[model samples]
Target chain A: MHYTEQSHTFRKIIMTKRITLADVAADAGVSAKTVSDVIHHRGRMREETRERVRNSMRALGYTTNLAARTLRTGSAKLIGLAIPNFAQPFNGNYADIVTSYAWAKGYRVSITTYHRLSQGLRELSADAYRFGVDGWIFLTDTPIPAQDNFLNQDRPVVLTGDYLSHGVADTIMFPNVEASQTATTRLFELGCERIGFIGAPANADSLDVTTQQLDAALTAQEGNSAMRLRGHLTALLQHNRSPLPSLVGACTRLDRSDGEKATLRLLDAGAQFDALFCANDAVALGAMSALTSRGLRIPEDVQIIGFDNTPDAAFSSPRLTTIDPFTEQYAQMAVDCLISRLEGDETAPTVHITDFALIERDSTRH
Target chain B: MHYTEQSHTFRKIIMTKRITLADVAADAGVSAKTVSDVIHHRGRMREETRERVRNSMRALGYTTNLAARTLRTGSAKLIGLAIPNFAQPFNGNYADIVTSYAWAKGYRVSITTYHRLSQGLRELSADAYRFGVDGWIFLTDTPIPAQDNFLNQDRPVVLTGDYLSHGVADTIMFPNVEASQTATTRLFELGCERIGFIGAPANADSLDVTTQQLDAALTAQEGNSAMRLRGHLTALLQHNRSPLPSLVGACTRLDRSDGEKATLRLLDAGAQFDALFCANDAVALGAMSALTSRGLRIPEDVQIIGFDNTPDAAFSSPRLTTIDPFTEQYAQMAVDCLISRLEGDETAPTVHITDFALIERDSTRH
Candidate 1:
């Protein structure tokens, strides 16, 4: 454990060649151990001796292999963080948090981004092996690659996002579907009828299983679209009451551009919706612009709700009502998962699904 | 280059023996060379033979020795992109670009962020050795680590933004001083002279040499507070010699928040400059917001110019007139410098500086 043989090599070379530690020790007239201790500065050496060793080391090109020593002990002092992309604000903050966290732990982190999902996941696994990282935390949107056919290097991998249906890896995910259901139920209780939904379509290409589950939960309460409408019409006929209007259609890709087009299309179709629910703040912002351009007042003409409580949401023209996806909580959870795995918590692949909160602002006051 | 001796002790016995090339070749009834060509998909292997080898490989569970091969060749296929932080929008895009570029080149990029300047440089040097990165491209705002004694590891280290001071390393920088001169000269040519500066203090803390150079360049032409005020006073010396107005003091930090605060303070101080030149677009935006809030029309009342033609500059309310800092071009040059070093071009360290372009937009076109 002491690596005394390598220390002998250091002693032999420094003894014969340029300025020997003995020469400095003779000048200072201290024991070689004292000089070595002073050179390493690891233990108690007189401050004066320490300064003299510091000057002696500098005077004689003494670059100790502390880094190499750490490496030889099978610990690279490195952690790996992988993300889908660094462009999105959410992922950007995620990258920042992981970097800060690793730095705080006295370990340096090396991050890698992959554009192609599968390749990203696979490459990260390969990197874990080649880099000999202490552990890996993957905040990715890609599916897990095949395991039996993996490169056969053993290392712990923690996946962020619970939509891990692959049944192969440990994961941490936010409760996306339950949160959406909660938001919808709250809107229904707010005496709002004829609510229109504007968001990206739930489809295979989207691959958002969490959102799809939310749609199912909502549909269960409202009944199938056509059947629900028919049932509402029947109830109305009996009570001489008007039927409630339902979501018209979901837009695919909920960016501002998508919101603008979707809003215009909804207005042109003469849908009498009193409230609009958007998938994210960017879409809601666009919808608000479109409605205001048409002289409709927020919560007066129509109410709007958005998801993803981004920082900008709080400061927009009319403060946006959104769901706090708790990106920080998610990031913390991912880190915890990775750390646990690295510590050998190999109890079957675990999943953590966090809850979401709805933050009400001026947009949804009605 | 051929590893014919496949009889390492570790390879001979294992708890669960892994399939190897010889097993796959034996299963396919072909030489290992034929299987190698099929696996690498190198030259021509008959479709029938390729399929036989592939099936045999699958049946035997053969895995490639890419790690061993990389170790043998000293090409780990990893590159390092060092940045100040990952969250800043500008540097975020830089990280993304380098990652995308490296991936396209069939190499992986590891990112290292240094929150503090010294710690970052130390980690970068250590990582260069530990991670087996072939080259390094450093885009930092602070000075390179003084203790970067990488004489032991002569891996390529190319820098951006004139960050390195005494270290003998390759660096790429933009013409910050010349660009500031150009921005000021262009304003001078615009005929309105009651100009005031609104930006971070002339001496920003922890700034690199290029920043100091830019400050010198701006001050060189009429270069002091009194001279600047005199230039502004001369502009108004034309009401038939118009009455001169006093120039304002420099604002520090040069961000949107600081810009707005400085603008409000200047307005409160009754500074009556006809034109305002800001440190950057963020400052210009903040100033524009303050002006709009005070009902002061742009160009009609106060023409403004800014530096750093960021993406949003072209889309600002009255599009911002700015200096195109060419961040992307900077990134490309840093990459070229790093690749050249990785490919063994350790020519004398030279400063690679590119020019900035003056982007005339709505803010400056009276």
Candidate 2:
């Protein structure tokens, strides 16, 4: 067999004949079972014998047959992380942290970004199974249905984000309602009334998930915007102020441009507000840009607060005062849950509600 | 054989007897060869037959042995992406773009973040081969040696970033020197003569990587910061303005906090400058934060410009004037190059010098 030499320091010797475990054992003068034990890191072996087997394997350029081993052990040592999108800085940061943590635990992560929110769960499960993923961590805005066969049965899954349904999988929920309430309360403490809300649904009533079935059917915007609005309204009600429908700006996406457009719409509509509560840092940044462009001073003209203390929140002009949803903690918890399940924990599906903190920066400082 | 019912919706059946291709063939009422062809998506089978075979396989819980097939085909259909770090937003965005593009091309990406700059290449190659990666896309600031065995012989690699060394891989250069030159020129055009730089090395002489050997031996800072500094100097020199060594703020990392500290360092050292050019958007954001904290107005006090036109640049207060280094285009080109190589386009290794555009925003506008 003619094998072309690759241009690397390690010469990739393409072989016509497959180098079997028996071949490696023969070269190392050991039994095939001993070679298997060494490969799997199963049984304890003499250091010299292990070294000899490893050396022989390297010499023969032996690559492990992962698929064959997976067939026997039903383990792939691969984790699939499905996110709605990566265009947002928060999602990207979340993925980075999750990947890093998973790597530390001797697992490799295959990231799949679902462009379509509605098809997210289906695509994530299909991709996960196709890639031979042992477990999955799905981060999505849309609520997953409990009847999802993949999430309910085949493999262990850990769901995260503002969505409500666990879909028969363990979930690590973000404290969106609590965080938003705290942010709005802080604005009121700063002497701001008639707070504007950006990145919320057009209808405030849609935020109510009174039943599990309704929660399962919740759209991404409905799930997140509703929770955040509820928080903002609760804060307003607590302050003896009625939630004004006119002050709410509906945004389809949680992006900076969306924030900008939503803020402009509110201003154009002549909505009266002394402060603004942006759904996320991206929206807050955009809102800040819009207000500054319109010659409105942050905290002076309109005190603004945001959610998800993304890296940009700390560096933005006026340095956005945002809610730290404990993203790292959320990611760690999701990973730990998935790992525990993979390690033979047959416990009932768990739901972890992550804690939040208000990161007071220059944007809302009096 | 008795089977234990798993906790999910789909009851996982543990079989005492292993199901084979012959079993699926018999169940589907097809020949074993037909079943094999259907599994591999080869040899042209009817749609009805294909569906039947697929159904039988699913019913019998037959999973394809990818490892066994990989041993025969010598292809894993996987690509490895090695980045310096994901903490920096630029690297995160780059990885996202690369992964998305790779997925569109029917290739899955395994991302590995190399924490240590010095051991980047060695670790990258080891990880790639260990995971049966067909190719690699490495984004690094460190200069790779020209005689790197991984690049010269093994799988094809496409290198991206400010580094000049291509080794045996194709290079997708970011045109850092030219972008920096243009940014500095823009500052001069705004009538600012004394320009301070954040994220450049303290020693200016290290910027000179005139020879291939020198380029190969260049440190991480020299590969990125030095090149950028050279561009700034070239622009200054073109306008008959001598580069002021004192005005340059040296930063160890291209991060927001580092940018802030570097700017403060320059100010404390009494290095007077009317304009600032940041290495990247993150640093520029930090510099902006520091300047604003000091009560200096953007453009009015110290005109500033940044590179990489990251998403934050558009949303930052005073909306950062930046050099759009064509990150998406660069990512696309790198993916294209790798895909071409994977498809057996064994032509001479190519070098792609990406173009840049100056995005004029509030930060540098008069």
Tens digits of lDDT, candidate 1, A1-366: 122222322221122233456766665556778876764547886676666655444333332232233334545667777776654445656777776766665666777776643444554654453554666777655344343323223556667733352445566776555555455555555656666666634345642223334334333321112222232233333444333332443445455556666777678767777777676675676788778767788877788777767644654445678778787777677676666666678677777766678899878874
**Please, what are the lDDT tens digits per residue for candidate 2 over residues A11-92?**
4333446578998889788999998988776888888888788666655545445345554577757777777666778887
Candidate 2 Cα lDDT to native:
0.73
Which predicted model would earn the best TM-score? 2
Indicate the worst ten consecutive residues by lDDT in candidate 2 chain A: A1-10
TM-score of each: 0.67, 0.84
Against the native complex, each candidate's DockQ, computed on alpha carbons, is 0.21, 0.23
Quality class of the docking in candidate 1, CAPRI style: incorrect
